[model samples]
Target: MRLSKLFKNAPTVNITGLCLDSRKVKKGDMYFCLPGMTFDGHDFIPQAIEKGAIAIVHSKDIIDKLPGVIYIQVEDVTACMNQCARLFYSKPSDKMTMYGITGTNGKSSCANIIKYIRDLKEPCGYIGTIAIEYGKVRIAPDLTTPDTLFLQRKLSDMVRAGMKSCALEVSSHGLSQHRVDGIRFDVAIFTNLTYDHLDFHGTIENYFEAKSILFKELVKEDGVSILNIDDDRYEDLKECSKARVVSYGIDQNCDYRAINIHENAKSTSFDLVYKGQKYPVKTSLVARYNVYNLLACIAALHETGMSLPVILQSCTKIPQIDGRMEQIECGQPFHVVVDFAHTPDGMEQMLRYGRQVAADKGRVITVFGSAGKRDIAKRKVFGELADKYADLIILTEDDPRDENPKDIANQIKEGIQNKPNLFVEDRYEAIRQAIDNASKGDVVLILGKGDEPFMYHESGRVPWTGDNICALECLKASGYGENNNS
Candidate 1:
C-alpha cells in the first residue's frame, strides 16, 4: 500500500491517505476536494496542503497555482476518489457475499431483517438508513449508500473482522451517481418502487432506471435476484436481468407466495405457499405490507439453502421493528399504530389495515405529513389518500427541510379540503388532535416519522419521537393505563 504503488494507475501522482474531513488529515494522506451543494472543497485545498497532505485530488476547473503541492487533477474528483477507495481496500467485497436491497420502501426493513438472521450464525455487517453496523461498532449514516471509498473501506474492515455477509441498502441516488460502480453484488433484492425522489430523478422512469443499475449491471452473474412479483416493475426487471431470478408475492403464480394471510392487531399468521408446498410462518409483526416483507426475506433465506422448517423456526421470534407498524397498547380499548408510510401507496395500505383493526364500532384517525424538498408531487396524493381512508385526517409537519413548514402544510391542506380533519403544523399537537378526536372504539395511526428520533425543519433538526413519545402521551391524555382498558 505504498504511495507510489497506489498512484501507479494515475497519470501523475499516487495518493496515500484518504480524507474528506481536513481535521482528520494525516501526513502523506490524499485530500479529496469535493464540491458540495453547500460548500466547495476547492476552498480547503490550501488548508489540506498546510496539514501535511502529500497530494490533492480535485476537478480540473479548480486547478490553482499551488506549486509545491502534488496536484492530481482529474476530470471528476468525486468519481476518482471512489475508484481509489476501491483500490485501497483491495476490493474486499470480492471475498464476501454482499446483498443489495433497493426500492422506495421496505429496503431498510428487509436489509435489517436479513442482517439480523445472518448475524445469528456469524458476524454480519450492515449499511442502511438505520446506520452502518459491524459487530459492536456502529455509526450514523449520512447517506443510504456511502461514497465508494467509504464503502470499500467498510467492506474491507468487515472482511478483516471475519464477517461472512453484508446487507446494504442501495439508494437510487447512489446507484445513478456511480457511487457503487465497481462492486459486484451477490444478491439483489427489490422491495418495490413507488413515486419518490421525483425532485431528483424528475420522473418515475428515471428513478426506476437508477435503481435498476444495481440489478441490471452491478450484480454478478452467479448472483441471485430476489424480486417482488407484486411490484409492477418486476416483469421489466426480469426480462433485463442476467442473474438467476426468484420471485415472491401473494399471487399463486409467484415462486413464493403467502397463503391464508390472517392479520390482526397483535400479530399475523399465514401459510407460505412455495413451489406448491405449504409452510406455516407466524410473526408478531402485523400489516399486509409486513407479510410481503416476510415473503421477501423468506425467499432470500430459501436461496441460501435454508430449509423451510429451519427458516420458520429461526424467524419466529423476530421482534417488532421500531417505528414500522410498531404497536403500543397501554390497556386502551382500541389500538394505536405507528408507521413510516410517507408515500401515497404506503398511507393507503396503512389505513386499510387500520380500518380493519378498528372494525365494527371502532373508527380510524390518521396523523401524517409530507416531507419538504422531496417528491413534493406526492403531497397531494398523500393528502387525497388520507382523506379517502381515515375517518379523521390530521395533517402535520413531517420534515420541512429548507422548505417553509407552513407552505408544505398549505399544499397538503389544499388537497384535503372539504374533508373532516384538523390542520396542526406542530407534529405533536397534530398527534394530540387525532387522539382527542378518537373515542373508545377508535384506532389512531401516527405515520411518517416511524422510528426516527429527530424532527427536521428549515431552521434546524429538533428532538422528536412521533411514535413512542406520542403513544405514552396519547395514552395518558386518553386516560388509559394498566387498569383502564379492562
Candidate 2:
C-alpha cells in the first residue's frame, strides 16, 4: 500500500506495516504515537525511530528534524491510526457479514452460538473473551474487543481465509474508545443493561450510553438490531438505533419470543414463537439467561437469511460454551460448576440456577470474590446476593491487582448478615475448603475466574491454572477420581 492513499496530500511511499508500540516497530513500518490511559506513545518517538520506523504519525509538534524519517503531525493520532489501518487492511469487514453482540453479560455465549450455527453452513470467525478462532487458527484474546488496528487486520485475515460471516463481542470500553470505528456491522445484538464498570463509566446511564454507540453508528442503515425486550432499557435502545429493530424476549411483544420454557440441570427446552407460529427449540445449555442468548442467535441468523427450521435444528447441536455454565464431574456424588460470573446480576443468576439444580438434594456452596481496582460499590452487592441464595459462602481473592486481598474481601464481608461465610485469601485453599466441606448431593460453585489462565497481582500476571482444572485436581486428591464411586 502507498502512504499517499492513507494520508492526505502526502508523498508516495511504500507502507510496509502499521504499528502502535515503539518496541515492535520494524524496518519500513509506520509507527503511530497515540496517547493511552497510562503511557504516551509520543514519549517513545525516538525509540520508534531507533527501531527502524520509517514514518512517524504523531499528535505533538516536533521542531527537531530526524535524518531520514518522515514525521506527519495529526490533530488526533487515534483517529488517524484507525483510518490508516482501514486503508491498509482494504476494509475487509465490508466484504463479510459482521454480527456484533454487546451487553453487560451473555456476550461471549451469544457470540459463540452465532459462530457455532454459522460454521455449520459455512466458514465463520469469532472474536470474544474466550478466544479468536477462524479456520483452524486460534489465538488467545487480549481484550474482549481488540484495538482498531488488530481488529481490522484479523478481519482481513478472515476475509482472505474465505470466511463468510464473523461474530464479535463488543465491550463498553471498546465502544467508548472507538475501537471498532471503521467496521460496519450487519447485525447488532443487545443482551441486557446492568450495573457494572462504574469505576470507569461513573454511572449506569453512562455505561448504557456508551453501549448505544454500536447500534447508533456502527450498524448499517439496512442492518438489523436485535434487542432483549425484557431489559428495562429496551425502548431506549430501540429509539436510539437507526437500523431496523428486531426484539426478542419472553415478556413483551417481540419478533422472537421463547415460551413454555422447561429447564433442568442439563438441558433447557422452549417453544420459540415468531410472528404467529411457534417452533419447538431444545438446547443442551441450561438456565433462563441462555434462553435469551439462543433467541438472540436465532433472530440474528433468521435476519441473515437462515430458515427457522435450520436455526432450530442448529440449536440442538450447539455445544456448551466454556466457562459460562460448564459442569465438571469426577465420579463424585455432588455437582460442581465453574462460571465467569463477576457482576452482581450475573452472581444472582448463577446462584439462582445453582439452587434450582440442587433442589431437594443438598446445599448450594458459593465461592467467589470481587476484582481489585474495579467498581468497588458492587462488592457489597455481590455479598448480599450470595447470602440470599447460597447456603454457605467462601470469599477468596480474584485479581487483587494493586489493592490488598484482605481489604477487598472485607468490603464484601460487610454486606453479609448472619450468614455462614469464611474468608480465605488464597484462592487454591478456598476451592479446596469448599470441596472438602461439601457432602453428597451438594452443589459447589467456583466463580469469578473461570477459564482464565492467570491470576493478576501487583507483581504482574502469574502463571495459574484455570478454575476447572484446579477443582478437578482437588476432587482427585480427595479420592473422587473417575474410578472412585464414593
Candidate 3:
C-alpha cells in the first residue's frame, strides 16, 4: 500500500510505514506526533526527521519548521493515526472472524474463554488485558485496545500468521477515541455495563456511550451480536445495532440461559438452555458471573459456526483466567480465592459466589482498596457492596498513584456505614491479616490487585508480589487453621 492511498484526499503526501516512535523511524516512514498524558510527541519530531521520516503528520502546533519534509498538520494526531492504521493493515478485520467483547467487567475472561473454544478447532488470536496472542505467539499490549496503527498492524500480522479467528477486548477509551473504527465485527458482545473509567469519561451515561460505540459502529450486515439480556443497556444496544442479535442470560426470556447452577469448591456445573433445549456443562471456574460469561461465549461460538456440544466440550477442559477468581490450595483450613473485583458489581457477584461455596458454616473475608486517580465515584459503591456481603472487609492500597493511600482507603470507608471494616496501608500485610484472621470453612477474598506486578501508592510503584502470591503465602503461613483440609 502506498502512502497515497492513506491521504487520497490530501494528495501531496505519500509514504510507507507509520511510526509514532522516533527511534523506530525508517527512511519512508510517516511520523505521527501525538500528545500523551505526560509527554508531548511534538518534542520528538526533530528526532523523527533525523531518522529519515519522509512525511510528517502532527497536531495543530508546528513546533518545528522543517523546510523539506512532507509536513501535514491535522486536527488530532491520534485520530489520524487510527485512520491511517486501518488503511495500512489492508483492513485485515474484513478477512477473518472478529469477536469484540466490551463492558466494565468480563471482557478479558469472555474473550479468552471464546478463544479457548475457537483454538480447539482453528487457529485463534486474542487481544485483551492478559496479552495479545496469535496462535502460540503472544505479545503484551500497553493498553487494553492499542492505538489505530498498532491495532491494524497486529490484526494484519495475525492474518499473516494464519489466524482464522480473533477475539479482542474493546475498551471504552478505544471506542470513544475511534481507535477501532473501520473494522467490521463478526460478533459484538456486551458482558455488562457498570461504573468505571469515570476519570476519563465523566459520567455513567458517557461511559455507556463510549462502550456502545463498538456495537453502534462495527456490527456488520450479516454478523451476529451477543448481548447480556441481564444488563439494562441490552434494549438500548438492541435498538442501536443493525446486525442479528442473540440474547443470553439467566432470565427466562433470554435466547440462551443458564437454567440452574450446581456450584462447588472445584468447579461450577450448570444446565445451559438455548432455544428450548438444554446441555449440561461443568466448568473448572467459580462464580455465577462466570456462568454468564460462559453462556455469552457459547452464543458467540455458535454464531461463529461452532456446535453447542463442541463448545461445551471446549469449555469443560479450559482453566480459569488468572487473577479472575483464581484459587490456590496448600492444605489450608479454609478456602481462599484471589480476584480482580474492583467494580461494585464484580465485588457483589464474587461475594455471592463465595457465599454459595462457604455455606452456613463460613464467612466471607475480603481484602481490597480503591485505585487513586481513577473512578472515585465507584469507590463508595464498592465499599457499600463489600459491606453488605462480606463478613469482614480489609481496605488497602490499589495503585494509589500520587494520591495518599490512606485517603483512598477512607473514601472507600465512606459507604460502609454499617459493616465492620479495617484499613491496612500495605496490600501484602492486608492479605496476611485477612488470612490470619480467617478460620476453617471461611472464604478469604483477596481482591483488587489481581495480576498486577506491583502495588501503587503516592511514593510510586514498588516491587511487589502479585495478589495470588501474597494470598497463597498468607494462607500457607496460617497453618491451615480453620480450613476443611485439617
Candidate 4:
C-alpha cells in the first residue's frame, strides 16, 4: 500500500506492513509510536529504524530525526493506526456481518453460541477468550481483543475465506484504547457486568463507561443493541445506547424473555417468551445464568435475521463451552464441574449452581484462587461467596504471577472467617485433596482456571494440563474409571 493513502502530507513511499512494537518491525513496515503506561514507543524509534521500519508515525515531535526514514506526525497515533489498519485491510468488518459481546463474564460463551447459530446459515467466525477461528483456521488470542492492526488483518483473512459474519468479544480495555474503533458492529450484546478488573479501570463507573463505548459509539445506526435487562446495569446501558434496544431476561417484560424455568442434574428447561408467544426450550446447560446467556445470544441471532425456531433447535445441541460449567464424568459416584468463574459475581452464581447440583444429598466443595497483580479487593469477596455456598472451601493458586500464592490464598481466607477452609499452595494438589475427600453424591466445583492450558506464577505462565484433565486423572486414581463406572 502507498503511505499517502494512510496518512495526510506523507511521502508516497510503498508501505509493506504495519507494526506497533519496534522489535517486531520488518523492512518497509510503518511503525506507530504509541505511548503506553509502561513503555513509550518514541524511545524505541532508533530500534524500529534499525529493524527496517521505513516510516515512523508518532504524535510527539522528534528532536533528533534520522535520515532515510519517513516521519509522519499525528495528533493521535492510536486512532490513526486503527483507521489505517482498517483501510489497509479493506475494512473487512464492514464487508461482513459483525456481532459484538461485552461484559465481565459470559462473553466467550455468548460469542461462541452466536457464531455457531450464524454459521448454520452462512460461514461465521468467532473471536474471543478461547481462540479466533473461521473455517479451518484457529489462532490463540493474546488479548480478549487483539490489537487494531492484528484484528483488522484477521478479519481480512476471514473475509478472504468467504466468512459471512463474525462474532467478537469486546473488552473494556480494548474499547477504552480504541482497538475496535474503525470496525462497525451490526449487533451488540451486553451480558451482565460485575465487580472485576477494578485494578485497571479504577472504579465500576469508569469500567461501565468503557463497556458503554460499544453500544454508544460502535454499533451502526440501524443495528440492534441487545441487553440482559435482568442485569443491574441494564438501565444504564439502555440509557447510554442511542440505537434500538432488544432486551432478554426473566422476571421482566423483555423482548426476549425466559419463563417457567426448570433445572435438574442433567439439563435445564425453560419457556422462552418472545413475539407475544412462549416457546418451550430445553438444553443441556443448567442454571439461571446460562439461561441469561442463552437469552442474550438468541436475541442477537434473531436480530441478525435468524429464525427463532432454528435458533431454538441449535440450543438443543449447544456446543460445550470450554471452562464454563464444563462437567467431567469419570464414572465417579460424585459429580464434578469445572468453571471459569473468576469474578465475585461469577463465583457466586457458579457456586449457587454447584449448591443446586449438590441438593440435599451432598456438599459443594469449591477449589479456586485469585490472580496475582489483578484485583486485590475481590479476593475477600471470593472467600465470602465460597463460605456462603460451598461446604468445604479449598483455596489454591489461580495465577499468582509475581505475587506469593500464600498471600493470595490468605486474602481470600480472610473472607472465610467461620468457614472450614484450607490454603493449598499447589492447585493440582488442592484438586487431589478435594477429590480424595469427596464422598458419594458430593459436587466438587473447580473454579477460576477453566480450560486454560497454562498456569501463571512468579515464573510467569507454564504449560498446564488444565483442571478437567487433572480432575479426570485424580478421579481415575481414586479408582473411579469411566469404563468401570459405566
| TM-scores for every predicted model | 0.91, 0.98, 0.92, 0.98
Which lDDT value does model 1 have at 260? 88
What does the lDDT come to for candidate 4?
Answer: 0.90
Q: Rank the candidates by lDDT, best first.
A: 2, 4, 3, 1
- Model 4, 332-374: lDDT tens digits are 8788989889999899988988888785779889899999999
Q: After superposition, how far is residue 344 of candidate 1 from its true place, in Å?
A: 1.0
lDDT winner = 2
lDDT of 1: 0.81
Give the per-residue Cα lDDT of candidate 4 at 107: 94
Pairs with steric clashes in candidate 3: 3-15, 333-480, 333-482, 333-483, 334-483, 440-482, 440-483
Candidate 2: stretches off by over 4 Å: 219-221
Please give the RMSD of candidate 3 to the true structure. Answer: 2.8
RMSD values for the candidates in order, in angstroms, are 2.6, 1.2, 2.8, 1.2
Error of 1 at 388 (Å): 1.1
Better of 2 and 4 by lDDT: 2
lDDT, each prediction: 0.81, 0.91, 0.84, 0.90
By summed lDDT, the worst window of 10 consecutive residues in model 2 runs over 215-224
Error of 3 at 446 (Å): 0.8
User: Candidate 1 at residue 359, lDDT?
Assistant: 61
